[model samples]
Target: MRIRPVGAYALLLDCDDPDHVEAWRAELCRRRDAGELSAVEIVPAARTVLLDGVPDPGRAAARIAGWTPEPVTTTAAADRVDVPIVYDGEDLPVVAGHWGVDVPEVVQRLRDTEFRVAFCGFAPGFAYLTGLPEGLAVPRLATPRSRVPAGSVALAGPYAGIYPGASPGGWLLVGRTALTLFDVHADPPARLTPGTRVRLVDA
Candidate 1:
């Protein structure tokens, strides 16, 4: 891991991978809640975590450098969300071909996998989820759609994502859900924040 100052009061930790980032973020969040670390935000990305609004970035960096974080466990029942989905996407056959499986097998595999939110990006409440095995990774479309409808469940590389709003996207659409992923009027706008576990159920 490489730690760099982001500004006057923040530090960005570049980790080895997404799993490493998640582990560090989990530990940092635990410390913050336990009053062992002081920070306003602990934001995670594809391969990094940003510790923002720290009182002393230098000291915090030194402290973090000496600490070791364990792997994150996502077995908490409270953090799990079940999303009802209709597996009738335009790219469903394409995905099945890529996986060398039939359409029904594709749906069964998706239902069996437990996904975790790695980060949020692209648009509001759009979460980049990780959990699909590396071997089952799929490629993006050769050409992106001009407009993808909201709640489109898609897969790209090793990540599974849900389109939060109607927008242009390149990911392979495999299913769709009706759950409101983002709501400005809600207490916590995004339903799938980082570390939240997700299960896609057949609707």
Candidate 2:
């Protein structure tokens, strides 16, 4: 593994061990919670983890090199947030048709409360949710949309997300919600955090 500086405060880790990213992430979080590291953000991605906030990037890298992080506690991440949805999206019927199931089934699946905030990115406060029902896995359109309204529940591949704000998107839009996933007035801004659980509810 190698740590490359991203800027004055952030560094990107070129992690070779693909399967251990989550383990490394948990460890980093543990260190942060214990006040062992002066890191502000330790974000894990598909193959890289971004470590940020360091007075000296080299020292931070050395600290990380000498130490290993632990996994997040199940209790701390146990609670799930219910996101109310209307289940009336433009792509709802089309998604059902592709799955060979009726729209009602799609509604039930959307209402299923067995998903988690896999990660957050692509947009501020927009979380990449995982654990979608296996049969409902779908692909993005050949052409992405010009604008996806905030709180638009969408699914593409094995991931699901609610657009925090209107923007170009590729995921199949399934529904819309009125909930605010991001708020500039809030201290942290991003309403959904990684490891946060999500339960979709029919409005």
Largest TM-score belongs to which candidate?
A: 1
Please write out the lDDT profile of model 1 over residues 1-203, one tens digit for every residue.
99999989999999999889899989999899999899999999999999999999999999999989998786688879999999998888999999999999999999999999999999999999899887989999989999999999999999999999999999999899999999999979999999899999988
Cα TM-score per model: 0.96, 0.80
Task: Say which candidate scores most in lDDT.
Answer: 1
Which residue pairs in candidate 1 have backbone atoms (N, alpha carbon, C) closer than 3 angstroms, thus clashing? none
lDDT on C-alpha atoms for all candidate structures: 0.93, 0.79
lDDT of 1 at 202: 86
Q: How far is candidate 2 from the true structure (C-alpha RMSD, Å)?
A: 3.1
Give candidate 1's whole-model lDDT: 0.93
